[model samples]
Target: MREANHFNERRTAQAAAFLLHRSGGQLPLIKLMKLLYLAERKSLELYGVPITGDKLVSMPNGPVLSKTYDHMNGAAMSEPGGWDSWISDRAEHMVALLDPSMIRTPEQDLLQLSDSDLEMLQSVWIDFGHWDRWQLVKYTHDKLPEWEDPQGSSQAITYEKLFQVFGFGKEQTDALIERISAQAYLAKV
Candidate 1:
């Protein structure tokens, strides 16, 4: 299992790298904006953070800004002169604001994590999307016990961990939970 996880991580990293290279070392402004939007939305969902109207404003000149931020005050933030830098900064800021403890290396908490807890977390990530969530689950699972029950109630833990990792707020988390529950129920039918 560990080997498989390592392989998956390596593959994911490689895929991300390839994606970067394919885009000439810079994702287009449109793609970056999309990612930013997803990050913000996920953050809001998992962490209970309200998506401020201001956060929706794109960096200046980004595609879709006219439609998304037409009524904003100042110009969109500058594009940082480089795609990687701009995206990285946006991601870091969005994640940090959504869950400061998650992104803050020295302030993280894992004292209550168990093996089953880790598995459930991985499941959540697989259910959600990929990249950040998957990486965070793998990291937590690797460091926690694997002997504990994997079927325990995990609502709070799942919510907290996801908020920590993905910066998703309460509304986002609730919606996701509802969506996942509905999907699971439908699958049984």
Candidate 2:
């Protein structure tokens, strides 16, 4: 019984971290509850917990599971209560059994980018600022240049030039480049 309680607490903490991470460090009660439900489900599968649907009831002020799940289909709009507050409250309640470090942070590292790479990034950003995922992908396929190895290329572009052109701090630009590289989205100049 003690072990079960401890597991539940850790699961709850992990759920909180997943929710906070996905929501960019904040989430409404509804969204958080839904994430918690999914996290708990994953935990059960992995840990062989005897927890059932009924055992996953929400706190009095928290969202009910059904309503919480339903909210996932709704449009992305701000909930009445602040997202930060809800996450903080739940996090505090579960802190005793939860590890705060379990939460994942957003990617913040920079990847190497050539001058051509920076140009492609800027162009894509400009062209698809308002585009959805499919539209962006389609546009990239139709219009973007193919990436090539910079090793043998004679392109004179440097990080300093990219910084000057993009008007982003060196660190910020590098992080963006790194993210693009990770996604295999960097374009060669």
In angstroms, the error of model 1 at 55 is 4.2
Tell me the whole-model lDDT of each prediction, alpha carbons only: 0.31, 0.33
Off by over 4 Å in 2: 1-7, 45-47, 50-54, 58-87, 90-189
* Per-candidate TM-score against the hidden true structure: 0.24, 0.27
Query: Per-residue lDDT tens digits of candidate 2, residues 58-123?
Result: 232321233223323232232433122123433422312123343333222111222332333334
Best model number under lDDT: 2
Return the lDDT, model 2, position 2.
7
List where candidate 1 sits over 4 angstroms from the true fold: 1-24, 50-189
Top-scoring candidate (TM-score): 2
Please state the error at residue 6 of candidate 1 in Å. Answer: 39
- Candidate 1, residues 53-139, lDDT tens digits: the string is 112322322211132222121233433221222123333213111122222221133212223333333343344333443343343
TM-score for candidate 2, residues paired by index: 0.27
